[model samples]
Target: MQDFLFYFLSALTLISGLMVPVSKNPVNGAMYMILCLIGTAGLFALLGSYFMAALQVLVYAGAIMVLFIFIIMLINAPAETKRKRDIPSLIAAAIAFLMLTVGFVMMAMSPELNQPMPALEDAETLAAEGAIPFDGSAKSYGFGLYGKYMLPIQVMGFLLLAAMVGVIHLSKDLHARSQAMLKVKENASE
Candidate 1:
């Protein structure tokens, strides 16, 4: 079941990642990117890193994606028009793909990768020995972030807030200019 899930999530991540660049509509591409992020979060979850999964979903899929879509809409990006693919470019792409495939195959067949990984130290044992255990769990991650990294987190929040305000101000200025243009055109017609 775990293997099946891993494969499913991997496929989801790959396909969504591919679609993000290939999609004709910018909004659709953003949506696909969100899916890719979500799939990545799932993969993280499968690896028992709940904190990373949550961060991936919250930061990348939710907040970042919303910001991206908002900016995309604000810019009024047009949907991509289909273009004719030239043969040379197609051949070049194929060659690049082939090279990438060969690289992966070689890496997978490397002798170093086939060796057994060293076992990790037991978290409880380390803690009992009066050493700090760096177990990658959500509880520990949250505690560390909120406890030790509080100031940095707050600073980042403020930075993001400032950015949001700036975007809003810029959008308002653009709206005002557009309104002025319409008024000028109306007066000229009369």
Candidate 2:
């Protein structure tokens, strides 16, 4: 059962991760990334790290993805415009893509990629031989964080708040500048 869940989550994670870059639209890519992050959280849960799983979902899929979507929509970015298929550029792109594919394949087939993670091996060994001690929960998580990670967490929270304020201030000024630019362009055209 554990093996089945692991494989299923692994496949989902890989598929979603691939879709992030394969999707034509940046918005779609960000959505795919959320799916990938969720899958990763599931994997962490399977490994008995509930705190990590919650953090993955809360931090990556929730906060980070929201920020990504906000940035994607804020600029009101357009879809990638289609370009004329010039032969030379097409050939160059093909060559570059081929090289990248080869490099990725080589890396995928490397010994390092094949190596098992020590943490995972330890988890599996414990599960197989004896009871998997339940050490992770919301209470434990809060205790651990407030005990040792309090300063870091507070620092990150303040940083994120500052960033939100910055973005809001910048966006307002950006909208005004863009409107002014549009007025100037219209007057020139007239």
Candidate 3:
């Protein structure tokens, strides 16, 4: 079951990731990116890192992706025209491919790359260690987050709040300037 879920989510993530860049519509691309992020979060959950999974969902999928979508909407970018691939772009892509191949070869030759995985503790042993028993309740997760990781969480919240305020200020400034220009035009007409 775990293997199935891992493969399923992994495939979904990869497909969505590819779709994000390949989709012609900016809105569709953004939506695909959000799906990719969510799929990655699901994969994280399958790996037993509940905290990471929640953080992925909360920060990347929930907040950052929404901001990206808003920015896309605000800019109202027109659909990109299909362009011919020039020789320089092809050469750059070839160089990138060669570099990746070299990196893969180096990694494969390294002994550390083939290191055996550590044995994981069973649920019974984890319970003995006083790890919070996973009762599937949100309260336990919330307690762990706010109690153990409160400082980092608060910092993230403040950063997000600052970003939100900045966006609002930029949008309002543009709107006010446009309104002022309209008023000036009206006065000039009068």
Candidate 4:
């Protein structure tokens, strides 16, 4: 049963992940991302890390995706002006790569990553309970979120708020530019 589930989730994740790139519409691509995230969460659940799975759905598929869609809508961004798209994508990709490197380092340092297999007594208790223990779940995540990571999370929220303000400012500038262009065209037509 577990094998079947794992394979099913693997296929779902792969297919949806593929769709994310192939979907031409940014909105549709974002929707596909949600599907992919859900599949990933299923895989996490099958691995017995249900809290991570829930977080995957809640944090990623829910909040982050909504933010993405909101930005996409608010920007209604102009037809891919090369300078606009290229520069931002390059900057974002570089930042993502750097962040990924930092993430791998943090993962390597995690005590859980070095943990040995569970003891026989603990395994027996889990079996008797017929449920994987919540040892890997919300308590630890909440602690880490509120403890060591609180400052960074708050900083990120501020950064996002700033970015939103920048986007609104850009939208106003773009609108003003278009209106100015229209005026110029009308004056020339006179």
Candidate 5:
């Protein structure tokens, strides 16, 4: 039963993840991403990390995807016209695909990948000895995030803010350029 669920969730994650990149509509792509995130949460649940699974569902599948869809709605991007694929682009894509395949194969072949996890008793012993930190609760995650990982989290927040500002600036510039183009066209027409 566990194996069946693992395979099902894995397939769901993989298929939706692939569809996210392939979907032509931005909204559809975002929806696919939500599905992928949910599948990831299911995988986390299967791994017995229920807190992480809930966090994944709430933060990523819920809030982040909502933000993404909101941004897409605001942007209201026009449909992209079909363009002919060139040989150079095709070659580059093929090379990229081959590299990804080779990387996956190498990772799968690694000795460390075959190692089994410790048993439940061993994990409990390690936790009792304060070695593994596997209390398996939201408190542990919160402490790790706010205590040891504080600096990295702050840096990530700062980077995200910077990116948001950059995006807003770029959008304003694009708007100004479009207005200028419109004025020029009107003047020429007159």
Candidate 6:
């Protein structure tokens, strides 16, 4: 049952991931990416890694995907162009199809991939031995992030701040250029 669930989730993740890259519309791509993240989280849950599953949902699906959707809406990407099926694109598609088929065959041949996991024995013993340390919960994650990963967390904050400032600067520059073009047109009309 778990093996079947794992394969199903894996297929879902792969299909969604491919859609994310192949979809021409940015909004649709972002939605597909969210689905991919959720499918990945389901796979993690099936593996008994609940902490990873939660992080996958919260961090990737919640935060990152939302940010991507916001950015896509802000930019308002142009409508996709309808191009004739070119030879190069056709060749690329064929290659991708072949690769996917090979991957599926490889997975089917691997019997270990379908095996079930061993049962958990002692929760406290696992924690003390650091096998599954820190309760594997959200609260423990926050504590570890603030305690051991404080410096990295602060660094990520600064990085995000820098990126925000950079985007603001770029937008301002574009606005100034557009205004100057309008002034030039007005002067020419005089």
Per-candidate TM vs. native? Answer: 0.64, 0.62, 0.63, 0.53, 0.73, 0.65
* Candidate 1 segments whose C-alpha is farther than 4 A from its true place: 86-90, 115-134, 142-190
> Which stretch of 10 consecutive residues in model 2 shows the poorest summed lDDT?
124-133
For model 4, how does the per-residue alpha-carbon lDDT over 10-39 read when each residue is reduced to its tens digit?
A: 998988897886666788889989999999
Name the regions of candidate 5 deviating beyond 4 angstroms. Answer: 127-132, 150-190
The lDDT per prediction is 0.84, 0.85, 0.83, 0.83, 0.87, 0.85
Against the hidden true structure, what lDDT does model 6 obtain? Answer: 0.85
Ranking by lDDT: 5, 2, 6, 1, 3, 4
Residues 1-190, candidate 1: write the lDDT tens digits.
9789999999999999989867778898999999999999999888767788888999898888998999899999565556786789878988998999899989988998977433346556535564445565767777777987899999999998999899888767787899999999999999
User: RMSD in angstroms, candidate 2?
Assistant: 7.0
Query: Taking the tens digit of each residue's C-alpha lDDT, what string does model 6 give over 106-155?
Result: 99779987765445554555455534353556777778789878999999
* Number of the top-ranking candidate, with TM-score as the measure: 5
Report clash pairs, candidate 6.
Answer: none
In TM-score terms, candidate 5 sits at 0.73
Clashing residue pairs in candidate 5 are none
Tens digits of per-residue lDDT, candidate 5, 40-150, equal 999998887889899999999889899999999998989766767577987898899899989998998899896766665566556655344664588878888888789
Q: Which regions of candidate 2 fall more than 4 Å away from where they truly are? A: 84-134, 174-190
RMSD of each: 5.4, 7.0, 5.2, 9.5, 4.8, 4.9
> Residue by residue across 1-190, what tens digits does model 3's lDDT show?
9779989999999899989866889899989998999999998787666777888999999998898999899999778777775789778978996999899989987998876434345544556564665533467778877987899999999998999899888767787889999999999999
Instruction: Give the 10-residue window scoring lowest on summed lDDT in candidate 3.
Output: 116-125
Off by over 4 Å in 6: 89-135, 173-190
- State how far residue 180 of model 5 sits from its true place (Å): 11
Please, what are the lDDT tens digits per residue for candidate 2 over residues 123-187? 54565454443455688677757876899999999998999899888768787898999999999
Measured with C-alpha atoms, the lDDT of residue 171 in candidate 6 is 67
Looking at model 1, the pairs that clash are none
